[model samples]
Target: MAERSIIIIGAGMAGLSAGCYARMNGYKTRIFELHNLPGGLCTSWKRKGYTIDGCIHWLTGSSWGTLYRVYEELGAVQGRQMVDHEVFVRVESDGKTFIVYNDIDRLEQHMKELAPGDAGVIGEFCNALRVLAGREMPSDKPIELMGLVDKLRATKALSVLKAMHKYGRVSIQQFAARFTDPFMREVFPEAMANMPDLSISGLMMALAYGHGRNAGYPVGGSLEFSKAIERRYLGLGGEIRYKARVERVLVENNSAVGVRLADGTEHRADVVVSAADGRTTIFDMLGGRYVDDSIRRYYDKWPVYEGFLQVSLGVAHDFSAEPQSLAFRLDDPVQVGDQSRHWMQMRHFCYDPTMAPEGKSVVIATYAFTNPEYWNKLYADQEKYRAEKQALADAVIDRLDKRFPGFREKVEVVDVATPVTFERYTGNWKGSYMGWMATPATEGTWMKRTLPGLANFYMAGQWVFMGGGVPGAILSGRHAMQVICKKDGKKFRTSTP
Candidate 1:
């Protein structure tokens, strides 16, 4: 039998993973990326001798587990150092501060000390974290391929399921309302303000993962981790074409047969896989002919995660002693686009030496939920757009100076990336970092990789997975290959670096 040929769109983690697995299964594959690099949203850029990392806060399954195995197979974890954070987050409200420590016991005690009146709820929360920490979820196969034994093995997660059932219904906002203490109420909401509607179960899982030291930041950050997988795919004889923007998925007789590039060049293949933006792939590339009611509902009504306006600085002073992430209420609100932000979260990359010089650090502040259309329209006047970015940076720096007395004077470089910047670099719809917002309404909702009435095509990316992240995106690619392998009557295989 002739080897099936596959043309994959996008060189992001999902596309690269699909290529690697395809090569391992004796399939011919080629990947086309819009940018001149891999890693799509998982990317970084250089500024005045400093590397500004744009993605990867904390990677789940940084240590040994099913996810770790996938990382190892894709070469994402090979020869890479993982930095385990001692404190997950530091939140300040009014004049008081609280730290969420990696140690559950320590975190519980700290919360009790901070808000002794809310000790009961704090204990309940910590106990839930402990229960979740002891449980593990299987990731070896897609749901369609899970055998009876696999189903049986999942029974081990009953305790986790119970905990989730109890807490998953409550939003972080509602969960905060359970706290009687004023400080506890403010702390819970502020700590997870970026995902305000996240379930208490989701928060518990994150804390559990952190407590186990399973969630760690890669030493070199997002770009290096992506490049590692890129190298692995190339080593397995997979081909990649960078700066190759795909204009359309060439469909003949209602089947995906190939792809047409922006340059009017066409490449035919037996199968076409899109790891690109979901909206573009469905509406623009395929002409919206294959969508069903479910698809329409997803596109029309689903809550999408919002993009951010990021202000990054290369500071000459070391921040190694500071918490990795700090969220504080601002005395003076900063104007960002059409909205005014009264609070901000700052991420310090002092632990990653690769991001800056020995004595310096890379500090980033993310102003969440910035409107992409606002930036998109403003960018028509290039000078005005640039000025707005600079003004936001200046305001953030002034605010930082108040917190860290010498922050303003010690800054050597500044780089700002807005929602429009994300849209230009990555074709993500509305420049969302993640596709769907992971709230109670959308969590655990599985999107079918194969669209209704579409054939010989599949999608592998965050767009197809609810509450998408590095693990889910990479695994989604593997699941696509699994479906293909089953269809071809061949077992899916994986290769290690």
Candidate 2:
């Protein structure tokens, strides 16, 4: 057989991973990215002397297990140091402070102390965490390509299954509602850190991973981590075209054969894979002709993750003693755009030395927008957009000053990225931080990589999967590669850095 060629769209984790795997399996591959750089949404930008990480709080599989294997294969974890924080987050309200200790025992103790009357609920939740400790997320195969053996291997772990079944559809908000204590009811839902709709089981699994020290922060932040995979892909002889925006998937005879660049250049390939934004790929690039009722329902009704704005501050002072993440109620509601923020969450880069200059620190303050469309529209008017950005920064800086007195004057660089920033830069639909929202109905749900009537084409990215992250992106690409190799009757292969 002749050598097969693959055209992958987007130089994000998924696209890069697919290229790497394609090269490992003896297929020719090239990746096209819209940005001059790689990483897509998994990126970081330099401001002044600090690097602001736009994605990844803590990678789910920095230490070991199935995800670790994927990270290893993609060269994301090769010689990479991970920082495991003792405290996941420290949240405060009024006079009360709640710390989410990565150590489960400490968490239980802290919870029990705060809400002794809700000890039963706390114990139950913590016990569930124990059940999920070291539990591996299913990555052996995508459901579309899984056989009897693969299915069996996936479900053989009865403990994980039982835990998942009991709490898989239950939201963290629902679990928090079970607590009798007022404080527990208020803060328990926040343990997952703004993702209240995430399954309780999913939250448990994260705490487990954090407690087990398996998932930790990659020292180099998001972009460098992505560049690691890009390097691996290139090392494997895969090609990448930066600033090469894909205009459309070239379909002939109901099969993807190649792609046309935004520059009007056509490139032929034996198979075409999209790791770009989901809506853009299905509707815009493909002309919305291949979608079925199911696909339409997904794009129409299924909620995409929304409402994100990040404010990064480069402080001349060190906050190494402060928890990696801090969430607290504001004395005054800071109004920015259409949303008023009474609460604040700040993530410090004290753990990662690469993020800041020596003796300085990078602090990121996150605020939720009621509507991403507000930012999208606001971008059209540059004056309003710049003012809103400054307003948000000013408000956050004021709050930061309140939290740590005398620290405001030490601030050097202040950068604000709104939802429009994500959409404009990564071309992600609606500036969604994660592709699809992780709701009770969405979690553990599988979306088909291939659309009906579209052959020789597959999708790999956060958009294809609901539980969006670097790991999911990597696995989605691997799944695409596996499906392609299987179709060609060739054994799928993976090589480590």
lDDT of 2 by residue, 320-348 (tens): 88878888888898886787767788889
Worst 10 residues of 2 by lDDT: 437-446
Q: Write the per-residue lDDT of candidate 1 for residues 21-117, one digit (tens) a residue.
A: 9999999999999999999988889999899999888898999788999999999998899999999889987888989898999999999998899
Clashes of each: 0, 0
Index of the highest-lDDT prediction: 1
Candidates' lDDT values, in order?
0.89, 0.87
Provide TM-scores for the models: 0.98, 0.97
Model 1 lDDT at residue 354? 96
